[model samples]
Target: MSLVDLSWRNVRRNFRLYTIYFISMLVGVVIYFTFSSLMYNEDVVTAIQNKDNYGKIIFIASIIVFLFIVFFILYANSFFMKQRKKEFGMYLLYGMKERQVATMVFFETLFLSAISVSSGILIGGFLSKFFGMVLMNLMNYNDDISFAFPQEAIISTILLFTLLIGIITIQSYLNVRRVQLVELFHAKEKMDKPLKFSMPFAILSILLIVMSYYTITIAGDTNIWNDYFKEALIATTVSLIVGTYLFFRQFSGWVLQKMSQSKNYFKGNKMLWVSSLRFSIRGNTVNFTFNSLISAIVIFAVGFIAVDYAMKGEVVKKEFPNHFAFSTQDDETQKHIDKMMNESHPIIGHETITGIQTEKISNRKTFFSYPEYYTEEFYLFPESQLNAIVDLRGVGEKVDVEGVEAIVLTRGIDEPTKYESHQPEITVLDDNTFHVVEKIRYPLLSIPTNPGGDTGPQPSVLVISDEAFEHVKENRTLSSFEIYQIKDPKTSNDVSRKIYDIVMKTEGAYYSAYIDMYSIDTESSSLILFSVAFFAVIALFALGSVIYFKQLREATEEREHYAILRKIGVGDKEIKRIIRKQLLFVFLPPLILGLLHSWYLLYYTVILVIKDLPSLTTIIFSVMGLYVLTYLIFYVSSTSIYYKIINEKNRR
Candidate 1:
């Protein structure tokens, strides 16, 4: 048979073993095609106001997907090449020329790549419809949805897979050329002792890790200056990655050595287990490190997406607590507005704070704040207050605002303590006299105050008195209005429409003041929730499948070792125990690190999304729960596959 036919038959016979790699490539293609389809969809094109920007988002997503595909293909292809070294050697020993052998290798890769890519694209085309439907549902795009195949996406997929396959073919050809026949034959037998690092390097790695953590913490808490803080975070992340890789490399050896010194070294299979694990880690340290980083990022991304979705619900509730909160510039629409409000919801006790705006042309400055802007002195408003605002128009008795020019603190304000200090500065305007008042703590009602810098509006200390309001409006006209909170939050939209109609009827005298009820749209929040859940499922599946398959490939090489141990009178139970231990060592560290990083990331991300982070207990428990469930599944699946391989080898 020709080399190409030989390679093809071998692939078919070993299809089960290669299925995982093929599936991964298929998934990458599917994701790429799905995203590309979304980007090129005519419906999406029409929906977005800024089509160019939408196109850019597509391009960016495509680029990210493409890079990931390249990395995954290259990594998996390396393993494939390693697995086939013996075959390559056999071909060379049969008197095949190196150039012919290289050509055969290239042809084999091209055949496999072509098959996988073509299947992926076809499957992806079908999946694109499903994905589009899901995305549309998540975004609340409910207007007459129909899936149409985008020619652009098809073309993009073809080009992308063509490039990927060409690269893999070249790499296979080069690898064949580089390896001598003897080297290829002995590739499976070439085992090197694990490298040991001095204590100083281990210490340095730990130090770097510590520094990275410290830097990230500082970055998280730094004042919201754009340039400096961004650079610091980027630097910290890079340092953390490098340090983490070095630590894994040296730490595995150090751990094995320490275990060897222990009494447990002679008990059971502790020594074997430790040695195997250390070898596995040392053998694939770079791969392990990169995998860890990828896992960490994936965890962080999933957590952020989840928390962001949850917070969107909270945002909507806070922004529109009651139905039809309205204000108007003119009194002519008052009766009509009241009628609309009454029709929309059962009116509870309605109250309005009226004030005239005058420009304080002398020395006063306008300042505002939200929960996020507060120092430790400003306690976030109690949930009860938010509930009351939503359900009952009664401001919870806990909030007390005093005189005109007094700070209308939304929540309680305490003096700054040692741990938390405030940067309270007063700026004098050229025309108006401004006074610093008690800071307010309200549920975030708008875009979160920029936490990274002091660029946006600070929390407001409401100067409640009409006199104080007037003092700040020198050149500005005094505009008077009322904010009415209604009994039913859901009816707020209907009431708003009624008020708009009234204001339209009143023409010149009544300008319908804009009250953003975007937050009241539960659909948006629901969509966000769906998107998070979908992506989380995808990420976990991808991570588990990739890791499981990679480990399975390696298991083939270790099958002989396990069989030899069995022949040497090691009990099957002991072998299994060793497998478990090795698996634990291989799997546990990345999870621990990823979870730790994810927890911290989620904590601050929550702070960014909502004014207050979730309770520490809640955050910790939720994260731990996710970790245990997913990790356990991964562990069980991986161990089962490993043991199965060993058992099969023993039988042979």
Candidate 2:
């Protein structure tokens, strides 16, 4: 038979062994194609308000996806080479030239790549509309998403994957060329040396990991954040990486060593898996460590992004209380804005917010116990006006400010004012003392607090009784703002753009429009969620597939050992039990460590950013549950395959 025919026959004969590889490659293709298609989808481009920014972000992300695909394919190629070394050796023994063997291996890769790429593109095309609808839904868009396979996306997927396939085929050819006859036939005989546990390394690994966690926790402290934030972040990252490596290399070995010395080491079926694990620990340490890090990253990324997407609306509302707000609005400008706004959207409610910007309040206290870095310009409002505004919005509770009493309102939960966490008696104008009676964590007005310079005032509000306000306003000029709540504010982009133009022309004028911010934020958030969710899924399944195949390789190598155990009267049930225990040890540690690591990361970072987010616990748990479920599926599938491989009856 021709070399091509032999290659095809070999693929068909070993189709079962190639199942995981085929599935993995197909998954990679689908992920890459789906993202590429979206990047060029005309409907998505037209719907997104900021196409340029989104284009840049998706392009960079696409590049990352491409690199990941290349890496995954190359890694799978290496695994395939190792698995088929004996087969290639037999072909050489039958007088097949080395060049012919290499050529045949290259043909095998080509066949698989052709099948995977075509199948992946077909599946991705069919699912593109569903994914598109998901993106639009996440962005709160109501437009219908029509299905069309963009030529750009298809071309990109084909070309990129072609390059990747070519690269892996070359790698396989090189691997075949370098393999010696003896090395090929005895490839499975090569074993990792037994690991020796060191007391110092084990303790050091624990200490390093603890130190890393501790640093991340304290990194949020005011003093630490100011002085050593960068250093702390670097230390935390490096220490965690080194610590995880040492943990698998040293700590795991020590535990297994202690287990082997225990009296229960010989307990029913424990000897079977334990002895096997101890024998393989040295080789498995690096794999476990790598997989553990990947797991942690996937969990942290998906968890945090999920929380961010879920809380987008709440966060936007908190940061921007009014649907339309602007400072320095005069009678004529208000008439013009009113006319423009009313033409597109009906105004639900409108309020003229009059307040005084004073630099007289003192004794500002913060939750972090540190002085703020901005000039404290208190935007003082009377309790009555504040109450009226809140009542109009129908959101926050009204506060009563008695004599010599004041209430502080901050921008939001995240942008805490200088005196946000504590209420202290403050002296206005250096003589009149006002006691802080209450504090509200809401941004009643969208003032340009610090406009990114060294001079502007920080956004802060102090609500005092009208009597106290009159006393303090002895010679101060009051600032007026126009706040409007509009109907269907999300659909008011055209009016917002016009109003924005008028506001920009007026000097010392600033406006915050709901549609302006909402469109950008929603689109950006949706893209982020889409991109990150894809990566999370691919990372989880791809790594899980790698682990699955790794175990299969181990099973194939140890098939003789299991047959010997069977000859010694070990029943099928007991062997299956042993297989379960062995696979459990292989799977659980990485997942548990990954969960722990991601929990700490989210608690320190995402929780702080979206503290008032609803159902945060549920979001985190749901992400982790999905991760565990994926691993569980892989674990079960691997166990079944491993048992089958080792228990198969010998055939001639």
Candidate 3:
């Protein structure tokens, strides 16, 4: 037969086996295409305002997908070669040269590659549009977005797979050339068991896990300096991941052996399950290590995303005190504000616009070294509490002290106020009179704000007294527009609209503004939604890639074992059940670990992000619901692919 004819006939004969392999390639292609489409989306591009960044994301994602594909092809090619070894040996025995047999294998690989790559590209193109719509919905884009097939992406994907196929073909040819005919025929036989490790390794694994947990827990503590804590956490996490794989390698078998020693080994296919698990853990150390790392990445991403969403509300509320106007200093807007407020609703409280600017009077050499004029804790006290303090101090007259200004400092001022502190001994050079007044604590309406520098909002501090306010008029402007606190924040919008109309009617009333809670709430909701969706995608990608590769490796290892089982009269259905059960064990540990890790991390991260963390029940249920649904989908998909592989082998 011609080489092409022989390759075609072999493919037809083993179509089922090739079909499983084809599906995996197709899925990988679809995932790549979907993510690429999302990265290049016009709406997403506009949202981020960085189209070049999307290019980088696509390139990085493509590289990752390509690496996985290369690994998958190499692994599958190895297994397929091994499975067909007996056939190759027979061909050699029939006086066909080894080179001729190698040529046939090359042709077979080429044919399979062409069939799979073509079908995958087509399927991927269709799925890309669906994924685009899903992405747009997730991003809350109202604009029309039409999906267009990326010819460049398809071409690049084809080139990538072609390169991988060539590499696999050459490697397979080399592998076939080296093996003896006898060895090739006997390739299905089980090899000797891997040697057990010493007890020290087990002890080390436990220590690493403990140390990793310790690092993660302490990483965010305020007591630890940021750099030291981050470095330590990263090092410990890396060590633990390495240790986890080693533990699974040497200690997993020891634990399974112990489990088998007890009566529980007989329950629920425990023996089969344990054996299958042990084989998997022992057989694929690299896979397990990468899988654990990927799980960690997913958990961390989810935690970050959840915390980010939770904090969005607080951030928006703080950044914009009111929905319509963030800060207003215009005088003309004051009269318009009053008219709007009177026309709109019963105002709960009203205050005129006021501001203060302070200059250093003490001639402090360094800015940071100067004592804090006001601290956040002291500023949070309410006016009633401050009045009580004032009453308790019982100062009927201001105490005159030499060289020191007696000032009654009011708490909760948004900006710094200028005043020189006077000691009893020091005399002022300027003719400015000074009196020693007690600092009274008072609360200003503490808006949801962060006080930690530019990273977050800072609390406002005020030093207010009629006497002090009059003395500090060196360069101060009079307070302008009034603020009316409405009984309902919703009324602010209506008030703002009325004020806008009033200002338009009145001459020189140039700027009128009102802030409502609704605008802030909407902005917060949008931010939270985007954050949640962004993190979710990242988490899904990390987890899915890990599971995909793990399943691929596990399936490869079991191919020969399943073939041997079929030879020994084990039914194909039974083999598939074993495969399914094995996949369950492989998937469950990481899923459980990821969920637990995500839960703990999410709690702490959110606490730091949101001022008030939600109840434990709420957090737990939310995480559990998301995790369970995601896990179920992944588990079903991974196992289905695995069973398809096993069934194909059996039919062959």
TM-score of each: 0.70, 0.81, 0.62
lDDT: the better of candidates 1 and 3: 1
lDDT of candidate 3 over 177-218, digit per residue (tens): 898988977765644364455567766776777676666676
- Tally clashes: model 2: 0
TM-score (C-alpha) between model 2 and the true structure: 0.81
TM-score, candidate 3, is 0.62
Q: Give the best candidate by TM-score.
A: 2
Q: Pick the lDDT winner.
A: 2
- Model 3, poorest ten-residue lDDT window? 449-458
On TM-score, the stronger of 1 and 2 is 2
Query: Which rank order by lDDT, best down to worst?
Result: 2, 1, 3
